[model samples]
Target: MRVSVKVKPGSKKGPLVETDEDGSLIVFLRERAVDGAANEALVKTLAKHFETRSANITIESGHSSRLKRVRIEE
Candidate 1:
Protein backbone atom coordinates (compact mmCIF):
# COMPACT_ATOMS: atom_id res chain seq x y z
CA MET A 1 0.00 0.00 0.00
CA ARG A 2 1.16 3.52 -0.72
CA VAL A 3 0.72 6.23 1.88
CA SER A 4 1.41 9.89 2.19
CA VAL A 5 3.53 11.03 5.11
CA LYS A 6 4.35 14.39 6.61
CA VAL A 7 7.79 14.06 8.12
CA LYS A 8 8.98 16.00 11.15
CA PRO A 9 12.71 15.67 11.12
CA GLY A 10 15.00 16.62 14.01
CA SER A 11 11.99 16.75 16.26
CA LYS A 12 12.54 16.38 19.98
CA LYS A 13 9.11 14.84 20.28
CA GLY A 14 10.12 12.35 17.69
CA PRO A 15 10.14 8.61 17.23
CA LEU A 16 6.38 9.04 17.21
CA VAL A 17 3.73 8.52 14.60
CA GLU A 18 0.27 9.95 14.26
CA THR A 19 -2.60 9.85 11.82
CA ASP A 20 -4.37 12.87 10.49
CA GLU A 21 -8.07 13.24 9.84
CA ASP A 22 -7.41 13.15 6.11
CA GLY A 23 -5.96 9.64 6.55
CA SER A 24 -2.42 10.78 5.87
CA LEU A 25 0.31 10.11 8.42
CA ILE A 26 2.26 12.63 10.47
CA VAL A 27 5.60 11.21 11.43
CA PHE A 28 7.80 12.75 14.10
CA LEU A 29 11.40 11.71 13.84
CA ARG A 30 14.37 12.45 16.06
CA GLU A 31 16.87 12.17 13.27
CA ARG A 32 17.76 15.31 11.39
CA ALA A 33 17.52 15.72 7.62
CA VAL A 34 21.22 15.37 7.23
CA ASP A 35 23.04 12.92 5.02
CA GLY A 36 19.74 11.18 4.44
CA ALA A 37 19.50 10.24 8.09
CA ALA A 38 15.90 11.33 8.43
CA ASN A 39 14.91 9.39 5.32
CA GLU A 40 16.55 6.31 6.70
CA ALA A 41 14.84 6.91 10.01
CA LEU A 42 11.54 7.21 8.21
CA VAL A 43 11.89 3.75 6.73
CA LYS A 44 13.00 2.07 9.93
CA THR A 45 10.49 3.90 12.08
CA LEU A 46 7.54 3.14 9.86
CA ALA A 47 8.60 -0.45 9.66
CA LYS A 48 8.31 -0.78 13.42
CA HIS A 49 5.07 1.17 13.44
CA PHE A 50 3.55 -1.19 10.89
CA GLU A 51 5.22 -4.24 12.41
CA THR A 52 7.02 -4.81 9.14
CA ARG A 53 10.57 -4.94 7.88
CA SER A 54 12.63 -1.99 6.64
CA ALA A 55 13.00 -3.67 3.29
CA ASN A 56 9.26 -3.68 2.95
CA ILE A 57 9.12 0.12 2.98
CA THR A 58 10.06 2.15 -0.05
CA ILE A 59 10.14 5.91 -0.47
CA GLU A 60 8.59 6.50 -3.86
CA SER A 61 9.13 10.24 -3.94
CA GLY A 62 10.01 13.41 -1.99
CA HIS A 63 13.43 12.28 -0.97
CA SER A 64 14.29 15.80 0.21
CA SER A 65 10.91 17.17 1.07
CA ARG A 66 8.80 17.23 4.21
CA LEU A 67 5.99 15.39 2.47
CA LYS A 68 6.66 11.98 0.98
CA ARG A 69 4.93 9.05 -0.63
CA VAL A 70 5.91 5.66 0.67
CA ARG A 71 5.11 2.20 -0.58
CA ILE A 72 4.71 -0.61 1.91
CA GLU A 73 4.60 -4.11 0.55
CA GLU A 74 1.94 -6.06 2.34
Candidate 2:
Protein backbone atom coordinates (compact mmCIF):
# COMPACT_ATOMS: atom_id res chain seq x y z
CA MET A 1 0.00 0.00 0.00
CA ARG A 2 1.07 3.57 -0.61
CA VAL A 3 0.31 6.49 1.64
CA SER A 4 1.02 10.18 1.88
CA VAL A 5 2.45 11.43 5.16
CA LYS A 6 3.30 14.68 6.79
CA VAL A 7 6.25 14.31 9.11
CA LYS A 8 7.03 16.44 12.12
CA PRO A 9 10.55 15.92 13.37
CA GLY A 10 11.87 16.45 16.86
CA SER A 11 8.38 16.68 18.20
CA LYS A 12 7.67 16.29 21.87
CA LYS A 13 4.22 14.96 21.04
CA GLY A 14 5.53 11.85 19.34
CA PRO A 15 6.37 9.37 18.01
CA LEU A 16 2.67 9.53 17.16
CA VAL A 17 0.48 9.02 14.16
CA GLU A 18 -2.80 10.61 13.13
CA THR A 19 -4.92 10.69 10.02
CA ASP A 20 -5.94 13.90 8.39
CA GLU A 21 -9.35 14.58 6.88
CA ASP A 22 -7.89 13.97 3.42
CA GLY A 23 -6.90 10.44 4.40
CA SER A 24 -3.24 11.36 4.62
CA LEU A 25 -1.17 10.40 7.63
CA ILE A 26 0.50 12.76 10.06
CA VAL A 27 3.59 11.35 11.69
CA PHE A 28 5.57 12.91 14.46
CA LEU A 29 9.05 11.77 15.32
CA ARG A 30 10.90 12.27 18.54
CA GLU A 31 14.23 12.29 16.75
CA ARG A 32 15.61 15.40 15.17
CA ALA A 33 15.75 15.89 11.42
CA VAL A 34 19.49 15.53 11.34
CA ASP A 35 21.77 12.93 9.85
CA GLY A 36 18.72 11.03 8.66
CA ALA A 37 17.71 10.27 12.22
CA ALA A 38 14.14 11.39 11.74
CA ASN A 39 13.79 9.41 8.56
CA GLU A 40 15.01 6.26 10.24
CA ALA A 41 12.67 6.86 13.13
CA LEU A 42 9.79 7.39 10.75
CA VAL A 43 10.38 4.09 9.05
CA LYS A 44 10.59 2.28 12.36
CA THR A 45 7.49 3.97 13.70
CA LEU A 46 5.49 3.21 10.57
CA ALA A 47 6.59 -0.39 10.68
CA LYS A 48 5.25 -0.72 14.21
CA HIS A 49 2.05 1.08 13.37
CA PHE A 50 1.42 -1.14 10.36
CA GLU A 51 2.54 -4.28 12.17
CA THR A 52 5.38 -4.93 9.80
CA ARG A 53 9.14 -4.83 9.60
CA SER A 54 11.19 -1.75 8.81
CA ALA A 55 12.34 -3.34 5.62
CA ASN A 56 8.78 -3.41 4.40
CA ILE A 57 8.54 0.38 4.38
CA THR A 58 10.20 2.59 1.82
CA ILE A 59 10.18 6.34 1.53
CA GLU A 60 9.49 6.89 -2.13
CA SER A 61 9.73 10.67 -1.97
CA GLY A 62 10.29 13.67 0.24
CA HIS A 63 13.38 12.48 1.97
CA SER A 64 14.35 16.00 2.97
CA SER A 65 10.93 17.52 3.22
CA ARG A 66 8.07 17.35 5.70
CA LEU A 67 5.76 15.69 3.22
CA LYS A 68 6.59 12.14 2.30
CA ARG A 69 5.19 9.36 0.20
CA VAL A 70 5.74 5.92 1.66
CA ARG A 71 5.30 2.56 0.08
CA ILE A 72 4.44 -0.32 2.36
CA GLU A 73 4.99 -3.74 0.92
CA GLU A 74 3.04 -6.52 2.51
Q: What is the TM-score of each candidate against the true structure?
A: 0.98, 0.98
Q: Per-residue alpha-carbon lDDT of model 1 for 1-74, expressed as tens digits?
A: 99999999999999999999999999999999999999999999999999999999999999999999999997
For all predictions, the C-alpha RMSD in Å is 0.5, 0.5
For residue 42, model 2's alpha carbon misses the true position, in angstroms, by 0.2
For residue 1, model 1's alpha carbon misses the true position, in angstroms, by 0.3
Candidate 1 Cα deviation (angstroms), residue 61: 0.4
Compute the lDDT of residue 36 as modeled in candidate 1.
99
> Candidate 1, after superposition: displacement of residue 43 in Å?
0.3
Candidate 2, residues 16-46, lDDT tens digits: the string is 9999999999999999999999999999999
